[model samples]
Target: MSRRNHTDKNASGDPRKRTGAPGVSAENGDGGYNAGIAVFSYIVGGIIVWSLIGWGLDYLWGTRWIVLVGALLGAAGGFYLSHMHGLTSSRNPAGGSGAASGPSEDGNSNAK
Candidate 1:
């Protein structure tokens, strides 16, 4: 008598296969942030940074509204650039979203 070997099969009768890992999509397997989120974050971050710089400059130069205007323009430009670059993932190192590198001279990231 001959014995038959049975293999696991899906409902469709195709051999069942296991995916390599979870949280990973077949597309863009880098495991980074979704393209939308990254672009939004970059745009927002750039705007905030540019605005802050403009505000500081205005304060130092005693110019009213000048810094605000410049900040607005800078923010707009930064947002456009970020969008163009498709700055998607702000997490995975492959996406270049890692934390700040090195230490500040004042021993604080927020040091002026």
Candidate 2:
């Protein structure tokens, strides 16, 4: 029932303390935490905003199914956004599995 100071040494007493996610450390000042929050916002915000829009449409037009469609669309959009931003492989894609890595008119390529 007591508050724990995450900035200080944890209960485990390990000097090199870590947080909820692997390789993420608030003490280390990494942006991983911010990135996690942004991803979550994308998913939840999409659902909430789209659902409200769907509700409005359903009310104005006297329909009962557009809500489902809007919800599904929001989920898909959210997932797409989350995948594009949250997933490291999709962001960097140094494995040559991503778009824009190929040579373009500017001769930009993932040479490394």
Candidate 3:
């Protein structure tokens, strides 16, 4: 008369379990949120880091306008990096599909 703890480790000591509901999409998954956060962090981090560098340069050179340029350059670089990453991921065929890729006769995919 004891209840089974399905959430805990199974008999074989394997932690993987497929007990959850299926048919979940990436838009509703954590992947999209994580990607967004990564992009945002890149942009923010670039701006902050470059602005600090520019401030240091200005302090050393006794200039007052290089900080703005540095900030703008940092933002542009961040945007470019994010855009490239987005493009690369979008171009990947396995990106949109949440399935394991298999080998094809035509040898188009690297999957085995």
Candidate 4:
């Protein structure tokens, strides 16, 4: 009467034991609220500050187009900054370049 180990490797070779939960994987477990919340806050705050600056500039220059341009630029810059910050933070802390290492469908890195 020996108990079978369900966690033992299956015929396909993958471990039968679950990692995190049913659907949750290792990648999804990392970076909880700090990633999404912090990035969102920074972007929103930056946009607000930029909008204020744009309004001031329009007031001083007496041109509405300047404010519009500023708003657009601010949005773009904020989005870019947020994306970069997320990318950097998601990387390895040991300065290991943190590039994702996995097999590609086309057998090349450029295959997307």
Candidate 5:
């Protein structure tokens, strides 16, 4: 006598696959989106904070060029920090096994 092996199937008679989830696409799973956001925030925050400081100095010392210098310095520092972050993250693809992981302060999943 011959036997048959039965498999799980969908309503369409196709074998059921265990692919990921239903609606969640696998695109951008490499952390590029998060990195972009982080880098952008760094740049903006650096500019705002440093520019304010420069503006304050200008108000006190009565000079305009200092504000430009401060803005430039902020931009350079922001880019450098972003680059360092990229290096660290690349070194640990799994995003470090230590603390300060998981959902961020905004409650968004860090895995994204």
Candidate 6:
């Protein structure tokens, strides 16, 4: 295969007039490495945040069980959060109406 020239020009003679990236869209697809990492972070982050809170409470109250409680709470919270915003969610990740949005109130189907 031949290499593309670095200074390739478009019909308008502007090399910088490029559109979106070939395959790198801002939209999120279902079930991939991104989803996996997001879910993992949700669970692990929950555990760490809750555990630290629990530990702080335990230290302040001179007790040894608050940390455990915090950890449990964190785990539960994280799981809940992940579930609500996980890959299986029906809601759009981009915060738009849903799917293609199917036209807007201005009545312009082709308007961005």
lDDT of each: 0.57, 0.64, 0.63, 0.60, 0.62, 0.66
Off by over 4 Å in 3: 1-31, 87-112
Off by over 4 Å in 5: 1-29, 87-112
User: Best by lDDT, which number?
Assistant: 6
lDDT of 5: 0.62
Number of clashing pairs per prediction, in order: 1, 0, 0, 0, 0, 0
| TM-score of candidate 6 against the unseen true structure | 0.52
CA-RMSD of model 1:
18.9
Per-residue lDDT value at 24 in model 5: 22
Error of 4 at 37 (Å): 1.2
Backbone clash pairs for candidate 1 read: 38-88
| Residue pairs clashing, model 3 | none
Q: Write the per-residue lDDT of candidate 5 for residues 17-44, one digit (tens) a residue.
A: 4222222233333345566676777778
lDDT of 3 by residue, 10-110 (tens): 34555464221222222333335566666677678789889999999999999999898889988887777667655214443345556556665678666
Cα lDDT, model 6, residue 85: 56
Question: How do the residues 67-91 of candidate 6 rate in per-residue lDDT, one tens digit apiece?
Answer: 8888898888877866665443554
TM per model? 0.41, 0.47, 0.51, 0.46, 0.51, 0.52
lDDT of 4: 0.60
| Number of the top TM-score candidate | 6
Off by over 4 Å in 6: 1-28, 88-112
lDDT (C-alpha) at residue 67 in model 4: 66
**Candidate 2, after superposition: displacement of residue 28 in Å?**
10
Residue 106 local lDDT, model 5: 69
